[model samples]
Target: MARNIVISGASSGLGRALAIEFAGPGATLGLLGRNSERLDETAARAREKGAVVRSAAVDVRDRDAMRSFLLDFDAAAPIDCIIASAGVTMVTPVPGEVEDLTRAEELFDVNLNGAMNTIAPIAPLMRRRRAGQIVLFGSLAAFAPPPDSPSYAASKAALVAFALATRALYRADGVSVSVVCPGFVDTPMAGSYSSWKPLMMSPEDAARRIRRGLDRRKAIIAFPLPLYLAARCQQWLPDSLRTAAMLRFRAVQRLPVR
Candidate 1:
């Protein structure tokens, strides 16, 4: 098991669940999130499990801040694993409507650039050490881009590509990189989407599955096998058919309070 773990977006959702799942005696956790109160809450829970916890309220989009935090934490205790779980999504409320440009920018900043910021600061360190694990959180939507949340799907798709490339690049250095593409997880993030969510999973269950995949050093950790398959199959359909199929799922994004 990885003894020193770093997780971003640890305030809530799958990130929080992953922090708790990995917490235990002899473990050292470095958690980063935008919300201080919720980040502290996650820290408290990990401490209860006898793990040493250090948390920071830092936005993943801030490259300098993320670099400093990651380096400082790594200096204290070499990081064994890093989970880049910060992300955001938004959808047009109705058919034929487009997402706001400002909102789409924010989504990309958080979902794509934010992930790169998380990995950039520490990847070299891990590579030099010749031992580490890096995990990126994508989404099943990457395989089947949603008409309502085009930017969200695009961002996740970019992450999937990034993960694969990085994995291949770092394989020779003994640094394992994995990407997680999960279907609708029963998180606050998911709650914002008013749409049919088949095979939705709880955060705890999602965390467990992620951990299992990490243990095996799998390149892609996608869960709810049926949904994953369906998403992949959707990619094979003709463009018109794919778009028609996607249009059937009505999703309204009700912005959640961070």
Candidate 2:
């Protein structure tokens, strides 16, 4: 039997690169994505590297589907890790300056709720076995909402508490919950929206760092030193001041959908 790993959002970008990074003759991969063609492409790449890859075009929001899939995937082979990489930006018909609640919900469903959906299903099994890893995708935006991406900021912000919570709760079960907060990566998802992305690395580079973090069982993995520092600083800033600054910053963008 080979070491098994499951990844969501494996159709493109970081997910695709991650599949490549973990590819090997002794590894088996279970990929989840909405696009069959793109998912097939990723599977092919992983297979070329000698990995046994299988994929399903399933929406993460479908709770029952997720649960069933996780159960079956784990049963087929002992799953060593699960990575929840599927997420969408704030595309609720709103762009910059303005902010709204509808956009917030849609993006939240895919980012935060989707994250929970991904981690929860396989948790029981991992707990019973007393060993496994869960990787949650967060963002540099989690620290500060950056006016323009309000809902997007809100969406990412929801994932911050996961690292500490998971570490404290799952330790007894020997299940490690890790969060990956990358500064910015050059991906189709990132390119779809316009923004000043700093210290952006290629998906390949991001995947490599993620792999290292998972191997070491790090509780939280953040990228590109500078962005990490800025995030920390925001955490220490005054709420009132941060709010004011955000308002001023928000003024520059058009407005997000409501």
Candidate 3:
């Protein structure tokens, strides 16, 4: 059967890929993004696939705007799936330099709080319907705090925790909640990193994995078996060893070019 799907950050990256994946003759898509041009491009592509597309160029950080858009979309079509895929990475601080507190807050507002803005308004509606999927985009960095990207790690970690908790709470309600923890995905967001990105997957492939996981109603959808296993093993390592190993990792320390 056709599904009513909503995707935030659908202008690019995994969000765009997922939209394309779900688009078809019977599908209805409501996509949101900050870039009007890109968002239009995505909508056009989905329309070409015979999917009914409605798109809005709006920042996820605008809670009222996000809430209104989502609520209206749900009222119109009754959402079957909602993916909170919008997020921003914080700039890695240089050695011996402290991260700017303001920048950290900005990153959190978009990455963590923005996710809440996207999911919170729709969660109850999904519960009432008793048949919908809520997918949250986290990261492998959620497994360990990267000294270089503290804010990003913290935001993703919070998502991981929140997704798990939501899954447990909503299981009986027939509302499936899932967290996707991808490693390095080859997106503009990942392009900002200056360090080696191991096992980086294309966004299409990542989206495929995510879709499969959601179809199976997985609670945690972490990807690339090798990388995921490595991250899991890090939890068992001694703190001193893990910290020393992580300290050797290097990435760009300057503010990201938005």
**Candidate 3 regions off by >4 Å?**
253-255
Model 1, stretches more than 4 Å misplaced? none
Superior by TM-score: candidate 2 or candidate 3: 3
Compared with the true structure, what per-residue lDDT tens digits does model 2 show for residues 88-198?
Answer: 875334444454676567777888878788878788888999989988888887776676676777767667687668878999999888888898799887766555676
- Assess each prediction's global lDDT (C-alpha) against the native: 0.92, 0.81, 0.87
Q: Which candidate wins on TM-score?
A: 1
lDDT of 2 at 2: 19
Model 1 per-residue lDDT at 205: 98
Look at candidate 1 and tell me the lDDT of residue 26. Answer: 98
lDDT of 3 by residue, 145-241 (tens): 6678888898999999999999999999989899999988998888866776788999999988988898888888998988888788888899998
Per residue, candidate 1 scores C-alpha lDDT tens digits across 1-258 of 799999999999999999999999999999999999999999999999999999999999999999999999999989999999988778875567888788888899999989999989899999999999999999999998877888899999999999999999999999999999999999989998788888899999999999999999999999899989989998899989888888766688777635
Deviating ranges (above 4 Å) for candidate 2: 91-98, 238-258
Return the clash pairs for model 1, or none: none
What is the model-wide C-alpha lDDT for candidate 3?
A: 0.87
Q: Identify the superior model by lDDT, candidate 1 or candidate 2.
A: 1
